[model samples]
Target: MKKMYLSVVFLLCGAVLHGQQTPSGKVFRAGAATSNITPKIGTSNNGGMQDITIRSIHDETLARGIVLDDGQTRLAIVVSDLCMISREVLDEAKRRASEVTKIPAANMMMSATHTHSGGTACPVFQSEPDKDYGKFLSARIADAVIRANHNLAPARIGWGVGSEPTQVFNRRWKMKPGTPIINPFGKEDRVKMNPGIGNPNLLEPAGPVDPGLPVVSVQTPAGRPIALLANYSLHYVGGNGPGEVSADYYGMFANRMQQMLGAEGQDPAFVTVMSNGTSGNINNIDFGGKAPDAVLPYEKMRAVANVVAAEAFKVYQNIKYQDWISLSSAQKEISLGVRKPAADELVRAKDIISKAKKPIMTSMEEVYAQETMAMKDYPDQVPLILQAFRIGDLAITAIPCEVFVEIGLDIKQRSPFKPTFSISLANGYNGYLPTPEHHKLGGYETWRAKSSYLEVDASTKITASLFELLDKLEAANH
Candidate 1:
């Protein structure tokens, strides 16, 4: 009897150390909220080669977030409306939230929506971030998490993936032989980005498009919706008026989803988040088709949002909501080399800038010359945060770059979870992540600019690290 008692005691202690709470009485809970992060007029906006000042506010930008607690472990997922946010800004936001909620910073995964008209938070090309706006943005992001945590209630969660093939197309195309495709670096490019519609010289697309729309929905035990988080690989659909600040299609999708699900006017207000997926090489333009009819400002984005939200609503109805499931998150920081300019490249860049007609670049050649000079001042290496989350049988991986669709597809194929999807521009911004083969083809995405300055092998390293993290989560959950 004494020996049996000792064995039982040891087993109970081990269970406690592993954080296995008693299953019979535990409950799964969730909460979601949004915090507006829209900038005032005259604030700097990103997503263009040159800096832009916001002349108007067409729509409000937001930092939408969800918090999930599986009776033991907690996880937070946030999507912000901005072109790109640096690692420094996200880290600060995480720290602030962690202080309030007691959740480790690593357990939170945050990403940007890649909205072209949102407030600037990272310097890309010539658009510099407004330092005050960055500070305000961080606080607002943290507030989103804090408010969501405060609203936690008993909930059920489910996930499913649907397809919207008609909306996504590979934007990079291979031109016919000897096509005059000149890059900003005075070199010939085999592929052209957004090659004009109906161009006979276009041979074929250079990459593949991912049409998967993965969604995770949470609701009260009695069936009232709490939040819906959806991921799609198509880049932002931009049709906002010039100098107008908007969340692009992301915000539109959120609003459309609320209406479709009849989630409006709820006590806590339903939150819907449309996160950008792996779309560095994907877009909505149909290059092989006829010229599209020009639409008024915000019209194109609204139409696209309706299509995506309709698909999401169709998928949302069929998901099998689980009353209780496990949640786990794993994060890692990896260092990558920066693709700095070569000695000869710097000399050429200086010469090009000296001969420019004006200080403000008017041509691609001049703009890239300045980018080359700026690359000289960057550090030899930088760190990126990679994260993965497991909710029941579904898996979500987060990469800090504008990840290519091929990489996302490869991860989905190899992941231990069945319905795995990737969220791009997550945790931080690290520029465009192209495959090594794409780098060799030398398209605009692989140009030697701040927007694409990671070493050629950065994607390989990031994917490998993510697999390790996913494996860790799988083992722990099992």
Candidate 2:
């Protein structure tokens, strides 16, 4: 019949040029949200000790977000299970998600999966940040970036790198020299952190382990997978026993990666995030081969969240999706020099706080060396805030502290970008930064309390201000 109507009009014009939706060349937009932010159960569980007991939540500490807009640069990356979130709750959650997604609070990129049982989610040690749980964690991190900026669409981006490295090791060790410990700054350290695993004068692990995990996958141009951002290096696994309050192992790695990617019977929200790299010295013990009935405590947080949710579903089944690329974000503010305690170490910290008789100080390395000689001349500088993002060739770096895994593998071996990872405790809190040869190997992250008091060349000036703001966000959208 007329050559079958010209072969059905050439197969309907090749299905209208392959249904024209997304082949990815750049229009890039994405969205994601999550809220929860746990807390409530005698709060205050900043990694134990305030008499280690009252802390019972068990799971539900979130505030995840993802909102990228490449209609010419827009980025909002938040992830907070907690146990650190200060620069006043990450600049009041990027100024209330930049007052309802007007975006730009320095292109907002907050982080904190440093989950050592993240419960009373922030107001850290000596109080003053918990005015109604910091406005309910800055209104649920700006309601998860204004519900991921009202759900932007047309997405596709993927990046992957895996290596569980036998359940992340390197918790500090290195003993044998007349094996006599003391550490938590009671002094006598030759390196120690979980030093008891098969103690026989240990002699190893003084740092090294990037058992990688880098993942970044956001789909849905009809592929359906709204989010997945991962970056590991261990440093959170807690046993969930005594006083519970756990999100440890990052709430079993975003609820077993939303039941392995397909988000199962759906909607507990599908956006799994787990950033916390530079492991501040890595964790999830192996200590001389930890086994007594293998994996316990929330079953080793569901076996390390099912080996990082099966490597983010093998990096979202090897992403070949890309709708657009070329997005950028950069923010900086560096200034170190808060390493006080001189003047004969503040006269031996007021002669050990005049024999610490009470203010409840039975040792936290003598009340953080009397809180580093009572904040010697008060906050004389430590202001940090470094961020850089440029998805599509993926490189995200943001450091606030607890950093270490060899400065996140030396900024991913001098990042000129190539799946470069690094998201350590983002926004603020500069406790341990180590490395000046691990502060001459003193251990407990180079004691001097007030939480590993910075400035031992604060890791070469925050690794040269995050490689000069990652070469100015790689010479931005040009």
TM-score of each: 0.95, 0.34
CA RMSD, predictions in order: 5.7, 19.5
- For all candidates in order, the CA lDDT equals 0.91, 0.75
lDDT of 2 by residue, 326-353 (tens): 7777777878777666686677667776
Lowest summed lDDT across 10 adjacent residues in model 1 is found at: 16-25
Cα displacement (angstroms), candidate 2, residue 341, comes to: 0.6
lDDT of 1 by residue, 1-478 (tens): 9999999888765553333454344578888999999998998887688788899999999999999998778899999999989988999999999999988899999999999999989888878888999899899999999999888888889989999998899999999998898888888888999999999899999989999999999999889999999999988889889999999999999999999888888879899999999999999899998898989999989999999999999899899999889888898989999999999999999999999986677688899999999999999999988999999889999999999999999999999998999999999998999999999888889997878999998989999999999999989977
Q: What is residue 458's positional error in candidate 1, in angstroms?
A: 1.2
lDDT of 1 at 124: 88
How many clashes show up per model?
0, 3
Superposition error at 212 for model 1 (Å): 0.5
Best candidate according to lDDT: 1
